[model samples]
Target: MGLSAVPSGPGGEASRTDPAPPRDVAGRGAEAARLADLVARSSRGHEDAFSELYDLTASRMYGLVLRILRSADHAAEVTQEVFVEVWRQSARYAPDKGSVLAWMSTIAHRRAVDRVRSVSSEVARDEQYAVTTVVREADHVWEDVEQKMDVERVRKGMASLTAIQREAIGLAYFGGYTQTQVASLLKLPLGTVKTRIRDGLIGLRDALGVEE
Candidate 1:
């Protein structure tokens, strides 16, 4: 059939037309399925599958480790350890348990935590403290520029907060005190400390525009 022309509006201009949006759902589903298949194959000693899996997850795993350890060198070391462990334990992964990404995150978290604990222990020992003297000195230098800026921002944010809120946040994050420990340190009731921490975090999140 011959098409009929629609009448133009106002200044004889045709109305603007919008194009259909691209569909990403099928692509994402295919990628997920591919990763699952790769993981399954890697478990059975498929080197190509293992390499592909590593390529997919390495950046994410390294970023996770770096966030926890806060040191590039340590993050690199832990990332290497994580992939080594992943390769060794690939056979232990069960499809029923979780996604491949979740399994990788769990391993990365454990290794990063272990590294932190190990460093803490070494720092606690007097003999090894000397060996870490350089680390301390470097930290002092770095703190003056980078950390000082962070501290100032935190301090400014704290200044905008109630004294109790600032206290709660300081104890929890800087002092590494748990809610119970924070309560103990401040000689406040545990419930009060909990409330303060919750409120403080909310305020900080709002102030910093952190996504919930």
Candidate 2:
């Protein structure tokens, strides 16, 4: 299970303490075993082991967070937080439950989800406060008529989009999901999702007679 480099020989070449295994055979299970060892060593207060663990997992962890949050800044912050938690809770890791990657991914995913909910809650509260504090005045009849017409135009424009384009746009813009998340939710390729959204917006713009 050791993933460390082989010791050097007298001539400074890697010593063959054991025969090399086929990469195709050793790739998947070997990585899992190495990660498990890293976690175990980290739990024993080995900084080097923890550093190796972070190097191995940080990219994947950050990618997962970015996919959920759709913000590089937030993803970087959350990735750092995830490693801190992993270092603090390393001793509590139970390898029987799952692989190290799975456990770490779970922590990263939960942290990202909590951040999304917290931001959403704060935004909602701020919006409610703004609505309550704003002065309400009766609009002129002409103003009301203009607003109604604009609403109808938007509704009709939305209706003009194809079903797939509408669904992608709805999930990305209104439901507040990233394009990658929309692709996963719809079981479509990411490029396909992007195309749908782009096409949908163009259709809406054309229908609304919007310039540029």
What are the TM-scores, per candidate, against the unseen true structure?
Answer: 0.49, 0.48
User: What lDDT is reached at residue 191 by model 1?
Assistant: 98
Among these predictions, the greatest lDDT belongs to 2
lDDT of 1 by residue, 1-212 (tens): 43345454323423223222122233445666677788788888899998999898886797677555656667678899998888888888876776777788889877776675575632432343344445656666755454465455555667777889989987665444468878998999999999998898888766544221
- The TM-score leader among the candidates is 1
Which segments of candidate 1 are over 4 A away from where they belong? 1-27, 120-212
Residue lDDT tens for model 2, 55-145: 9898679767765565656667889999999999999888888878889999988887677657653243233323322322223244455
> Model 1 — which ten-residue stretch has the worst lDDT?
15-24
